[model samples]
Target: MSNRTGLARVLDDLGTTLIDLVRGDPARAGGIGGVVIDDPHDDQVLPPRALVLGVGVREPADVRARLDELGVLGAAGLVVRGPVVLTDEVAAAADRSGVALLGLAPGASWTQLAALLRSLLAEGEVTDSETLGGTPAGDLFALANAVASLISAPVTIEDRSSRVLAFSGRQEQADASRVQTILGRQVPARYSQLLEARGVFRRLYRSDQPVYIADLPDDDGGVCLPRVAVAVRAGDEVLGSIWAAVRAPLPADRELAFCDAAKLVALHLMRQRAGADVERRLRADLVSTAVEGGAGAAEAVRRLGLTDQECVVLVLALADSHVDDPAEHARLLAERQQVADAFAMHLTAVHPRAAAALVGDVAYAILPTESEDRALRIATDFRTRIGDRVVVGVGPVADGLTLARSKAGADLALRVLRAGRSQRAVARVSDVHSEGLLLELADLIAERGDTLTGPVARLIDYDLRHNGNLVETLSAWLDAFGDVAAASAAVFVHPNTFRYRLRRLAEVGELDLTDPDARFAAMLQLRLWRPV
Candidate 1:
């Protein structure tokens, strides 16, 4: 395929020797699809995507009129001469029309630029020269350096969000902006602000072709370097981008080489993603085996490289919403799992001994902690880092052998949170103890029904038959620990009336009202069994 680049890049490659007095928003420069050398008087036809407008000197009115014509023809940008006096009306028209305005150096010839661009546009495959001339084509750093050498510029590989992944390590060509971006592994906020202002990110995400940013100025209009970037994609999915900083437009050969290198970069990203998926599956299997109480559970934990830790705390997070479509649900589940793996990677980066897994839509982490405080900190960090998509549940610290119990605790906490039984984002095992126990008991009560608790069942039957508040009064009395006034107030009834209800309950159920053991059983039953 023909190597495609953005207009901004084309300008940068041209350099000050060939171009000067560039006006209009540099950020709005479109992806250059072809070159259009305008005849002095003939009609001009704009090309698809983006096209470079080449013209000789024209009056300001003519310039504005051409801009209008280009805008109507859906032209991406325009290119003109520096000596061609640019009027405010023309500049305003260019800005309003979203056409990138370019002015060439006084001595620059349109013919030279046209020849250079057309040749590059026609060139196809790029041969590897430097690191990949004789060496294998698998090393990522080598690929980056090779592309840089081919283009005679500093190169950096970045993801879609402009995060610097690898650089060619060209110290001589590195500027303040490049240095900071490499060191921080992301574009600096100030630089990002300038690019964002011109809608560069929006255009980058939308276009598959290379975006050329020429002489990008700082937010304060300070001189900035020029860069050419092309998205590394697999079919329709954009994986990352390759950037090259150059003083002049890349030669046709080098432009072809950069395009070829992009295909390799796409392969690397796809392999990386596949490897991560395999790692997640392996880690999840280990965690599942450990939590399911297998004889090899300790072996599995050891395989994860966790040792010399006093305790392991388990944390689980579950997605709050569900999707009905199977494909979409699976995609969402995969995204969630990727998020969980990233969480695990973050934990390991900080603590070295932490491990995590994704079980369906739920995420689980087994973190080695020195103390309760550290575990709490990890839990808090998780809550802050994972954001609002999932509800977190933290289990108490336990030894590796008892990891299953901790996992169960976390699962219970997650269940409670999902059921709307808790308001906190990070629900701890201790926090959900009462609710968890009640839910477990409720399961057993539901399975056994009336056979499990005769007295509570009798009271429930009596209330159902008479439409009375006997069950509520009894439950409130037990909840208040046998306090008459508190229980009466809880039921919104007079103390004397509650006392009379208690007497009637005791007589109807044939139960003792004074025995503490019997009262405790009744309290447990009341908490578990649903009243009729």
Candidate 2:
């Protein structure tokens, strides 16, 4: 791959010399120094510091076939001598196969070709390390390839809204543009979700750490089913990510290696991004400073031509992702790079809190460049893909002083979604309920048996005896016992015997059976208890 390695070039030059030595005759010496053979399907033999010579002596077809068979062998060179003629196509093939060509005069000895090669190749040698140059990473194309090679993880470098900046391996595995097309066309809601999730991507970028999640192929929209994800980042800068959706999953070592690769990629990207940042920093910084209400600094920023309000500076985070080991964040993200690229556009807009993705199934993006319209689009769009399932919320935009508060509202909305299965996938700040009767009821259930064990005592005992078969037992008991026959039928005994069982009812019923609170508490405990 280096310019200094001219051995291949030399081989071509050697072919011409040999051909001239033979006087275009095939009868005297079978080509001694060069001949060509090609076999795409077969791996020809190659020896270290060796030469190959092929000789063709038959009719044109036979000569070509023979040349092809032997020329591909990595030989010092090939030679041919015979009663034959060479054509343009035949000569080209010989060069492509690395065969040096030689032809002896009709009555000449083939020894002449052998002597010729010995003199030319005896001086070949390797260049020293000092003469080598550094690898170039001056442009995006080189950087992308270098990143791909370094991380060995499927990853995509993205902008704030998770828009694809650069990525590798997608061409052969998946077409990212096709996905964007589908998102832009068939499912606009999902596309918006990805944009909202951009916040999540930014977090990984700024922190230069990996973000991990599960089953979010298009973090902006697609539901790949729950699977692990890892995203990598650098201080306020995002490099890329690596992901795997293996049905059986990857082993620990491979996962760790992925994290390491992500870190390496982050370092590389940071170096490049810093250079770019320097080139654009003055304009960006002035605008960003003025946007946060620094009117006094307006003069400095005005030169960049960006008005204060138009400048939006945001710290984005990838939420709704969970990683088993926080330490492996970088590696995990690198492994999932391909997936990240696929959904970069939408992930950029997610609220941050929902970013705890790897645990169960929630990913949040922080929308930095606030707007009511953009927020609404993200919410509605997110709903369509993650389904009416899961809560996707957008916080009202706020100036820097209260930006965190906006996210807090979105977090509350997500909480409402988690509390029950009936909530819509996308929610607005107005719909969130932090304090309500249902929440109180939920609170009571959430308290576990610590405060209300008496109510669940009998239910608990029943479960203990049946290997936790509460549903079946409840169904059977209600059918067999009726309102007043309860304890008697459960034991297959007479009514008086059941009255004795009823003695504990008042104490157990202290939870107020008539209250939805009590009913919910009872239901919750029964559902979660798994006694072995």
Candidate 3:
């Protein structure tokens, strides 16, 4: 329920737990716009009031130089690894630059710090201004802290899978296990196994009362603190749990209050879930409209916060979504949603303005960049990370109003990949343009109910009636550009045999293979036709 914002809010939440103020006043920086890692090798556009993580920066002089540089860029704060040496020059630089300086705690990684800051910032991004019990809707950290104050202990809010969602401050006061959980953002597997063996989770979930556990033996043979846990439930559905590290069992009155807190927690959890669903649907609608490109497209793009920026469109689709079993189809559908969510998170982390949404069976991403090569690299990395279950198609970069053309290109490339015509799992439109064109041609012919004509049709008919290999031989020859040796090798036949079949096909179908125009027409037909 703290009304702190920007640098002050970050300090209030994470200070002394994962970071400490090294020098300068945090209040000097008004509001933090975004979190960005400082990479000296690559140029970056620092959003206004950015909090830059000075990873690998240790020297006092380097810190001062970065502070000065960030000052001109209007950055809010700079965080470097501890123990930071407080020098007069660094202090003076911070004072002159009007930027706050902080240090990440020892044993805490730069990655962990960045994640914590971003999570805190994302909570503020929720458009809802509603509050539950004076706590902002979905503000789990504030709720966790409030619960900690009531219980007189540090606590963690965890999802059903035992993954830590949010944690209260004073975590250092807790045991080593609790600190480990906070650091890793999940209950360790060994601890979960021990609890499962004890039937603790089963008992906790079976009842609405608080479950208490005595001290447990740690991996180092040391005794850990006791804990009290209560499930957060909405009706009969268990949403998550709130666990408090305590020295002794809670009294009856406090236990009643703890149970009451679970009810409030349930409301917040449900609100959070519903808000996420609504946000996703809204984003999908905006992306769908923007990519369709019409009078409404400009407004949709602006609403998505992508106005006036060059962007590359990417389409992602499952390589194989078909299954005979109903249950298996449901599983695939759930997996698609999971992949889309992951993709959206990944793109957002890369660029704050990046947008991704599940539109129909395909997930479309609008990356705010002017380089198709960079877009291809991002797609390739995602494809590799997700394994071979998905394929991504990258389109040419386009401005906001022209996004439809980019989306069309991406759709064409994705269609080619999904058709199993290409060996690649990720491709740009330029890389698979020919294959995409053939697919378009197939679609056109199918729509028009066009049947095969000319020599190629005759060859297909002759092969079907006579059980001959003439069509295959002609396809191979055209694919190899009339190279008899290569075509024969490709079809696993002797050059002489291949030549005999080719000549027979030309004679029987009345095809003038020697003529360039005839060769082109036959090749085009073969490219468009798929044999039954």
Candidate 4:
């Protein structure tokens, strides 16, 4: 793989298909630290050598102003929607800031552009230093470009579901629908429906021979360019397909080359899938070792690229839904993996050194920051974005060796939330310390097989035998702090009736309501027996 890392590499890979260089010099740009979408509504910290996406900025004046701002922040490049007019003012701004200006292809969505850039940037972060067939392992973009070169046409690598995994440059040579497909990263429903209606996929997957598709009519009373597709296979299983937009049918030699490329693509796809699984397992092991803290913890932390800094641990788990059906359980497991991947990506965007991995049912993250408050905000924001199905527990900031302590605190906080003891979906240890302690006490009692023996226990026994509301009455009265009227309202009874029940329970249990110690004992027993 090429050692290119920033604007130069981005242009080399995605130039004609997704982006175009408009001004400044790619050579001047340094390595890209991160990719960030510029949000005018909020104040966002930009990492050094940042690539800023100007999603909505269009006019020359606005573009110029954004260039100047990004330059001050030491951003390496600015990307705006294209057909960009290279006016003198815009050129001057780019030169003054020493920031490369690129134009995003028209008809491509900002979401698509951001995803492409992030994936491209992530390739530079891989430490494996392994290659397959002269290209970096799992480098689908490079594979796609290679296939395109062999066929003498633009190409796309697509999965079984017809989702575009990678596309070569010169996508402009294809029809408008091809551009739309590349932009959305999937074949549009209309196009796929048409293909299905024609039995194109069935024919393509049925044989090793290339299936040639003639021009198809579009919704705009036009026709798409012809295409030749071949299914990629590993032994008997069909992995995906390679699609090429050609102006005419290929001659015999090119057809042979196209088939050979599919075989190569199959090897790459299998390697990519295997590599991802191995990487995930390795990360999980590293995260487990670091969070457990001990002899090997410091080394594990360093391997995760988090060392010599105060960091907080965040543990996230799905709220219990008590799912029992086998199909639902499988779906739930898949969803957990998806959420973990998203969490890892989100943390990476926040801080390049942040590490996250799914360990069992929970996702653990090591965020390199000392401020628990900032960690809380980040957790809260993530929870809000992911919805109420998930909960996050943030731990105190700790040094490398003490990360185990932070992990413990986070686990306890997560347990409290999972037990339904707190209404919050995101909380720090301090916010739920009392509840966590109560849960631990309950666990101790359960472990020892201890039964209730206090006044509250007697009240419970009497209620079961006589069908009385004594325990409820006492509980409400104690909860109200001896306010008879409030306690009566709480249980929806008259004050006199509530008072009578309370006094009757006291006599039956031989309890003294006036003594502070007695009250404390009764309250503690009630909480342990039935937590609120």
Q: How many steric overlaps are in each model, in order?
A: 4, 108, 0, 0
Tens-place lDDT digits, model 4, residues 1-532: 2345678878877867778899988878868877888876755767788889998989999999999999899999999999898889999999999989999988888887888877777666554566667777677788888889988899999999998888898888888888888888899998899999999999999999899998798668878899999999999999999999998898899999999989888988898788779989999999999999887999999898778888999999998645999999999899888888888888776776788999999999998888999899988888788888789999999987789999998999999999999989999989998899899999999999999997877888888889888888888999999999999999999999998988898999889999999999898888888832
Q: Where is the poorest 10-residue window by lDDT in model 4?
A: 122-131
Off by over 4 Å in 3: 1-3, 126-129
| Candidate 2 regions with alpha-carbon error over 4 angstroms | 1-332, 335-374, 379-391, 415-425, 429-452, 465-532
State the lDDT of candidate 3 residue by residue for 188-291, as single tens digits: 89989889999999999999999998868887998789999999999999998999999999999889889999999999899888988998999999999998
326-428 per-residue lDDT for model 2 (tens digits): 6676655653332232223343224211111211133333333446556666556654554432345556666534434555566555555554533455555
Best by TM-score: 3
TM-score order of candidates, top first: 3, 4, 1, 2
* Candidate 1, residue 428: how far the Cα is off, in Å: 6.8
Candidate 4, residue 193: how far the Cα is off, in Å: 1.0
> 1 or 2: which has the higher lDDT?
1
Q: Assess the local accuracy of residue 84 in candidate 3 as a C-alpha lDDT between 0 and 100.
A: 96
Each model's Cα RMSD: 19.9, 26.1, 2.3, 2.5
lDDT of 2 at 248: 36
lDDT by candidate, in order shown: 0.68, 0.42, 0.88, 0.87
Model 2 earns a TM-score of 0.29
